[model samples]
Target chain A: MILAATPGTATLLVELGVILVGLALLGRVAARFGLPSIPLYLVAGLVVGEGGVVELVTARTFIESGAQIGVILLLLLLGLEYTGEELTDALRDHAPAGGVDLALNFTPGLLLGLVLGWDVRAALLLGGITYISSSGIIAKLLADLGNTGNRETPVVLAILVAEDLFMALYLPLMAGLLIGGDALDIGLEVTAAIVAVVTALGLAVRYGDRISQVVFVRSDENLILSLLGLALLVAGIAEHLQASAAVGAFLVGIALNGPAEHAARTVLSPLRDLFAAMFFAFFGLQINPTDLPPVLAIAVALALVTAATKLATGWWSARQVGIDPPGRLRAGATLIARGEFSIVIAGIAVAEGIEDDIGPLAAAYVLILAVGGPLIARAVEPLTRRFSQLGRPARPRRTPTARGTTVS
Target chain B: MTEINETKLPGVGTLHDFESQSGGRIGVIAHHADRREVVIYDSADPDRVSEGVTLTAEEARTLADLLGGTSVTKRLDDLRQEISGLAIDWLPISSNSPYVGKTIGETELRTRTGVSVVALVRGDQPLPAPGPDDELRAGDTAVVVGTAEGIDAATELLTARAR
Candidate 1:
């Protein structure tokens, strides 16, 4: 065998290997620093991207397709874990607050985008993308801060779920507009999605165990293959219907949610992790450093404004719901991270070849969110505690118990 | 004074009364005194000390005397060990079942199923282990922990469809 065959293939392999290893190590480092690993992985991608050491993943259609798969899988898993009852409860409890938060963040983002001389559609897309709260990062931070057991976790989780649902609808709506798709086409796609979801739910109820036993109980390898096939099949169907593939994957996840599904997850987790890592890495690779400097300043300002708006919105709504000040702060802080959806909107604008000038600015905004999301989340607990103390009257403290006693 | 072989029954305990003593490995007497005589023990291999002849209390005491007082202690230990390793099985709720969309507390699952809900999985996420307030969704999978009888009850309740 030839030691090194094709130069193009060799270079691609080396770059891919190096980027993955570097990102993995950097991810560990980020965790050690008490930061979310997503940003670090993104940073690793940037380092190995065009302007950095080696460019492995080019800004090509195929790479975008792969990244899309990653997003679909991520959302699909999200859907799988979601129960309609819990989600409905969450929406009912937080809808007013969520709506208010949406308005507060989106209005300012829209005005800013307009002022910046961006296209109307671009402005709206940007507004929607920026207005979203980072549920993943916030949830992770809450767990890290040992406040997952707090009363606020559920409320905040609900809010995030509501926000995600909003984004799920909004992202496609924006994409449809940008891609020149008609309202009737969009409606048909949405209807198809609903029908597919309902069908999956019906099937799950009727034959979940038999299907799981037959598909997953055979062998570990077979289980992995079946789950992957299912994810891909659902995603493909969604794409064919002109609906977001992520939505289909999520529906599949929802359908499969149960005891047998748990077994399936454990086996599929490694595959999901690997693909997710690639997804983020691809995001990092797409950032063009030459266009970043001017965009960075504007992006940072927009991110701060969005974060502050969300914090205020989350806090006020939470307070209205009778949540304690500290809990509200925690919720507000956790809502700061944003990811793929925002970038996807920006990517659509770029792909349509309209408002190409703002593409760099949108990328910069994503980068800032990537960095700032974790910082805000990390600070939420300490900040909440400080604020809580300030609001409280001085009183004699009870001696603490080792196992932890509930506060009255 | 009596000499006992302590090495034969390692770490065995002595009984204060002779009636309570076990001649060999002590076993749970499963049947009535008049029926087929059998004892349940942890050991795969049990030693026999008697022939076809009926055993008197004195004869039993004499057999115990030969085996040493340690046999009784060893038998108790073995019985405890066997009971501890008993397995519990759990089944998932079928989608069309009435148990779906109900809370564990509302179901009176503990009383009916004899099995306690230890954990639940809905999709990819497991519920923060499970608690009373956590409602059971249609697709949720519950991990029930209990004895065989308890598990049997739980399975029946979980798999039962809406009336």
Candidate 2:
């Protein structure tokens, strides 16, 4: 039956369906191997994108839009995860650690970018990509490895909180700087952005209960719709103000509190998972498969150096909190993975057309780290145990609770 | 009651830990996703957890019930011995309770059921010797003092929906 083709609709549906199924398969593969699914998604994009086995023309626009939403949802969820109290506490106790983390981890990427002759703005973007560890991957890793309850785990989490809060300020400033114009225009845009973000954050912290009450609806569907609508509207407004849409969405997330925040996460996580997949794939699609190989050496070098820096950051922070060497190692190893946010940064750079090689290099760099990070985390404990015997006698196992330490 | 240290774990959830009678440090992590993890700290290194067991939401509830049920009964027994014939009861205010959002004076609890709400526990704050004008909110635990029959009647009257 030679029925008329339904213009672009049929092809779009087929392409979308095939892509989703492929992603699901890749997700399962990732789960089976105990690795984060991000690398797999990126690899899928590389293969199906330009200069690969297949090209997606009809679905390109859809994926691009989904990618944008994906970035918004990722930041939004991150904001929802922590309270203002947690952020303040993390900042109070771990400001020094945060500084160290920034200096050690961000320097590698920025230095690499400068060495490669990229402009300062593009180099800053690269610095951001390398600085932030993947909270999603680290959280999952902690839970998977039964390290969530470990003493050093909290140290890692606090550092992540510090990084996340920093992003709220950093994103807008970078976005403003990259918005090419005279210094005054850039300064005005950045100031407006910071003011907006700070005001929103203040409102969220002080009056979140009232805000949550206003947003709360009886039905989950209505609640989610309202949340999604608010996020998009705020993001659009922020984008108009030259403050990144993702940061706007993040502020909206912070504003929501109490039961509404909890319910919102339940309903929104699936949608986030769906859209975030598209975002990673879309990042891969922008990089021609051929571009990846040319950047592989640089990516590998960056990954190795950054991994060590992350380890040092974690080790130093954990030691400050009195955690043992092994625990510190665990913290460092877990912090090595850089996934969604790195891609988000790179995606922004690519859109700005700051550097042609930025997309491919970022994709390759993230891929190596994302895959290698968890493996190294898992290996660290055993490796430490093995190596420690050479330096000192093996520790004797102590009786459970023998210290007579009173309850605090 | 044992003193417990509560730590807020940024993105994870709350961690409540206490040293046991046996001198072992133990903690429970209540995850945002409703999962719970019971962990025992390493004796050699207090910073590390030597053992950890994850529990589903239902499993955690069950464990709490198993541990708490006996203490609840034992406390009631101690209360009974201290005041013979008179009884003290704690009644939770569920969201659907008729008394919710009403003041104690509005409930006319003492006049109707001969039971006095001696205290109200809202969240972590304990309002001792609540006045008649004190409001009754959902999720409050009212500590009522009366005879057994009167307390039972007050519990029913307070919990039942209005026609």
lDDT of 1: 0.62
Clashes of each: 6, 1
lDDT score at residue A303, model 1, on the 0-100 scale: 85
Model 2 clashing residue pairs (backbone): A401-B24
Model 2 C-alpha lDDT per residue in residues A240-272, reported as the tens digit of each score: 988889999988888887898898898889999
Separate DockQ for every predicted complex: 0.01, 0.34
Please provide, for model 1 over A1-408, each residue's C-alpha lDDT reduced to its tens digit, 9 standing for 90 to 100: 676668766765666667667778987887788776666666666666668666655333444566777777677666555544445556776788778878887887688879988878878877877877655566566546544434444556666676766755665555456555577876665565556555665565456556556655657777777887888997787667656576667656655645546666677666666667777766666666576787778888888888888778767776775777777776677777776666556656665666755666766776677668777766655666566657667445567866766767
For each candidate in turn, the TM-score is 0.64, 0.82
> Candidate 1: misplaced stretches above 4 Å?
A1-5, A51-53, A57-65, A181-218, A351-353, A398-408, B1-163
Indicate the TM-score of model 1: 0.64
